[model samples]
Target: MTHNSIRVHYGKRVVAALFGLAVAWGTPVALAEPVDAANQYLGVWNYDQPDRADATDIATVGQFGINPLTFPQVGTIEFTRGRDGEIIGHTDQGCTWHFRVNGDALDLTSTDQYCFNNVIGSGYNTYSWHVTVRDGREQEVVRANSYLGYGTFDFELTNGKRTRADAAGPGDAARLFTGTWMFDPTNPAYLNNLTSPGYQPKTGAVRIDSNGTGLIARTDDGCTWTLDARGNTAELAPAGQTCARSDGTVTMAFWSMSSDGTHVYTVLNSTDPQLGSYFIGSGSLTRQP
Candidate 1:
């Protein structure tokens, strides 16, 4: 099908026509590229360059070091269904790539380079990635167009151990926090009503630690919190700020996940009368690799 025709059919349902005469039994429907191979790479894969290459030195890889063929700057890659239902990847740094299964190999290329160039320092350069699944772990090869001309370097994409998310059974709220998480407790909005004039929202990563007891969360500014219990709540003291006449001080409380696993609901009581008292708000959280 033409690319334009495919784009037009995006998100549209294709109805199956049943055959009455012959029963086609046990044949699985063919799945589009990356989606079929999603299990091969959806989770985290530790990344490393053999002797520490330029890609590793320049880009931001995630905690588990996703994009092992690239850098160690710790970043994340999230997979979702595209308009055509193909596997689409979105990263924490704001880059998007698409994968297509070629024979027994999974091939992918960067479709969007926004974060790649901005955060990763890799410009419009498109690197072709071919990953082959082995008995235990998969092997990856990354080749730049420049390298293709000489036919010399197939910079081996570092392949590492892959880890999948833990299963938390049905109806468990803790499951929501099971994946990686972060939050910003220092948001100026956390300050009590008296000290600050308005409300500021906190930001950062949010995750439930392996022990299943600690809540690891952080903000964009790097302020971090590790909650030790399941139901405990704590008020945040704003980290001193350089913004207003005083160091930003925030007075906010944080509660654990509710039973349904949907929101990070919180109440912020600002010191500034103009901003009002006891502001209630909530944020939606998604699972991260």
Candidate 2:
């Protein structure tokens, strides 16, 4: 869909933005050290780029015109903790990028001259990458997308690998989040920044379905949601087009779940890349029968 995207204009933050990431194209990952909220994303994430022998090309794609290609252009994403107590994000693609830790999930955006540009109609440009890590130690997914010209181009891949000599019965997801969960009005956790508030916390019920690997959930609203399960905690993100504010403002958010899986802390980080105006909000959620 063509966005009412301006060549250069950013709106203010309303709340807070990936995958559009389903099944990965998976690989064997050596077990990393036990991870926690403080440092769950402290390692290198590699994408399973397709080999030229395995590359596929198409014509009249995303309005960028027909061109020959093999695999999506993406590189490794690394996160390191600074000595002064800060998280740093780096990429091998040579794009100027920055990152944030919203709960256990990592958020990265690069809009530098070398990172993001508009050419959607001029001659499409797309560089998207996605990967999922499973069964080894960290069960996670990383997604990235860019469309420069024409209509949007979409890419998806699926593959699998089992590191354990034998298949384990199920994943932690089964035990952590299943069935229905409802938001608690009181004692809810939320992230609210700025002088005045512009939005309210999400209410109503949230339904979750897990298959031992990850979760697929839907909010009372028409939103597809996903959870990133760390060893003891889980992080939440929008799985598809998120609900918008009454004024048509949009948000990018990350919710943190309590270790017991009973309470969820919410943070709506409203940020505008162009307009430079932003707001933040916080709230809480609890489990239900």
Candidate 3:
């Protein structure tokens, strides 16, 4: 036996021992086995929320609430491994922290999705969302459930409102559009959630002014957008404002004057956010003195 050969043989034994020990640890070996399930649905968990939900919605029942929220209908969360080899999860609703997997618990450190990660963490500082690891088939189910993102449900509408209105108004078609145009409150907003029809318009106003040979418009929502006028009609495109849908589908709007230049008709047509269907929302803007 030579000294160099002995050293080489000792190193090989150390590597084999480490590998065997890792196999005995269980879950890590299970997670690293397929490599496919971990690859798919590994990032960006898109979970949209209304005011109500599974157990999480129990607290906000009577205090007045809203469904299909005004903005950001979808919440995004992602989990990734850090430089220290610890797993971290972050949510778009402003929460981030490291998570650890122990025996039967996945302990998340700081961030909580159900209202626990607050300055007080009072109404929600706790509670339940657990799964069963029944029988000898538990590991198989765990491996398969992560990939079970399939099927659909019947959409029902208990209450819905969308405003729709067609009324008279006044506006000038010349001088590249100048003056204040107020969106009528009676203008109907429409919603068809595959179950019911609704009408409840969003009240807003825009001020249009002439600058050089071009037209410019600003909304009360603090969005400055460019107006390209091609006669009595113009395309209102926001430069870099998220004034519309979260998906940027309704980024621009089209405005046209009634043939007599009495009312400005504004509309936006795009794919529905919730369901991939056609969506068209319109507003009747009357010139305000």
TM-score, cand. 2 vs. native: 0.34
Candidates 1 and 3, the one with greater TM-score = 1
TM-score, one value per model: 0.35, 0.34, 0.30
Ordered list by lDDT, greatest first = 2, 1, 3
lDDT of 3 at 54: 32
Question: Tens-digit lDDT track for model 3 on 61-124?
Answer: 1112333212112223455665543446564334554544434433444333234222111223
**lDDT tens digits, residue span 1-289, model 1:** 9998886676343423223212366455555665465556554332221213333212222223333223222222445656553556564334676776667776674533222333212333336656565663445554442122223222333443221222233224245444564442442222311122234544445545434544555534344544432221212323222212133433323222321243333322222223233332322233444
Winner on lDDT between 1 and 3 is 1
**Model 1: residues >4 Å from true position, as ranges?**
1-73, 83-85, 109-124, 135-138, 143-161, 165-214, 217-289
Better of 1 and 2 by lDDT: 2
TM-score-based ranking: 1, 2, 3
- C-alpha local distance difference test of each model: 0.38, 0.39, 0.37
